[model samples]
Target: MSRRLALVIFPDFQLLDVAGPIAVFEIAERYRPGSYDLTVEAVEGGQIPSSSGVCLAARPLSQGPLHTVMVSGGDGTRDVEGLQGIVRWLRTVEVQRPTSVCSGAYLLAEAGLLDGRRATTHWSRTDDFARRYPRVKLDADRIFIRDDDVWTSAGITAGIDLALALVEDDLGAEVARMVAQALVVHQRRPGGQSQFSALIDLGGRTGRFGPLMDWARANLALPLTVEQLADQAAMSPRNFARAFVVETSTTPAKAVERLRLEAARAAVENGFDPIDRIAEAVGFGDPERMRRAFLRAFGLPPQALRRSARS
Candidate 1:
């Protein structure tokens, strides 16, 4: 009678949404192979196709003492036909084995499972979830949210963070740390941090000044000053700044920081570059400025982010 973890897979499944948590859980199981059971269960009883054309099969929605049942989210999950099955199954949880995951928050919202509960979904879906499920306390800016038995996350990659949190709850923080280390990831990843605190939450194509955002994301390393941006848009600094806030729900400077931080994150994730070099390359003067900015925006330092990226 091993503790079992089930992941609900469906068509248009975000492949990473399915893979990230599975990878972390499998990596954790590797430490003591054969200790726990892990299975990918299709919510609607079929070999479901993912957005990438991969087919995933599963056991029929089970009604057992499942320690953890994960709901993955993606473009395919827009409708509730497949997810009603999961919500119905969860209605039977005996002790609630600390279930959670990213993008899965949408389905929970649909089931009325998140009413009055704090939760997070992918930033892109935050507005839609808010519009659809007003009773659910939604925070698009957070990576993951935990309220008693139910847990949710912002997007696909945060699934790893959710998995790490579950491991921490089950085996203790030390084991979770070991699991994260084994997976080359950080265990204590902050749930409050947004998926891309500094990246464009929009499609980068909204507002009259949307072109500026698109340009900024592409050239984050450049000295993107108010003057430069206003010049590009052929508007005065005062006029453009005002219009920007109205259109994007954030200021231009803040948007630039998001882009810069996103760039820094990519650099940290891909290679072993010095913090100073990374800071400079990402448009900061040095590690100190980047550290403060990263801390302010992401609640983590450049080094910590680099370590997490490496992990």
Candidate 2:
């Protein structure tokens, strides 16, 4: 029996948000032959223009026993004040599973579908999303989150990762791997992985001390004391300490430790260097220090992360 899969979109919706997941299921159908019947839908049932200015024709929202229903997100979702019709429609739809990509969670939340559910969306919208939907437990760091029948993903590309996970669940890891290979993506990224890189999350490039941060990342093996960093930024030590906290929301020492931890983790996961050598190269000084840092940051030691990466 073929499962009915509907992808719901709206005007100015993200193009990839719709295309990525559709491609996943389409490929899965090729593998399993009659596995899925796909449809693209919109509130008005016409030519819907995406945020990218590309238009996709869609059918009007209809009620039925759907196997899966997915909603996409974009700038159109930011101010959903005028979307009460679609919100009402979403509130009344019946499906075995409901999912969202990116800010699409906003629509689901607006329709009261995500109330008291664990969900995630784009990291950059964490603050606003929390304020708007207080009942939805928003875990901004996750790549995707699933609470029972409702699945929500973060940002744009994370949609593909979420779809891949669904493929794994419906088919198996082997089918998921084949789909990922066809798509030229990692087989699956753990949902718990941080949405952004450590440096980017720390505001390394956009913050006031961005240049110093860039230099610091490249010189992780050097002694990156607060005083030394202050000198590089041309500020007094005390003022620099205050400014660093204000800009990065972390102490200078903690920031340096985070940078070193990122570097050491990459080396541990991707290279054959000894633990002690990786530790020293990333300024952790010794294996024990690196192990402790990894435990604090990732709740596991360096060895565990490497083993997980291999498996």
Instruction: Name the top TM-score candidate.
Output: 2
Number of the top-ranking candidate, with lDDT as the measure = 2
Clash numbers, per candidate: 5, 0
Residues 63-158, candidate 2: write the lDDT tens digits: 868888899989889779866777888888788888999999998999998999999998667779999999998887678888998999998888
* lDDT (0 to 1) per candidate: 0.74, 0.84
Q: Return the TM-score for candidate 1, rounded to 2 decimals.
A: 0.74
**Cα lDDT tens digits for candidate 1, 1-311:** 35688887767888888788887778767765764688888755778888889887767766667777788888766876656766666666543554445567777677667889998887666677788889988776677878887889877778888888877776677777888888777445677665644335552335465567788777767899999999988999999888776565457787788778778877876778888888888788678988987897667887877676665
Clashing pairs in 2: none
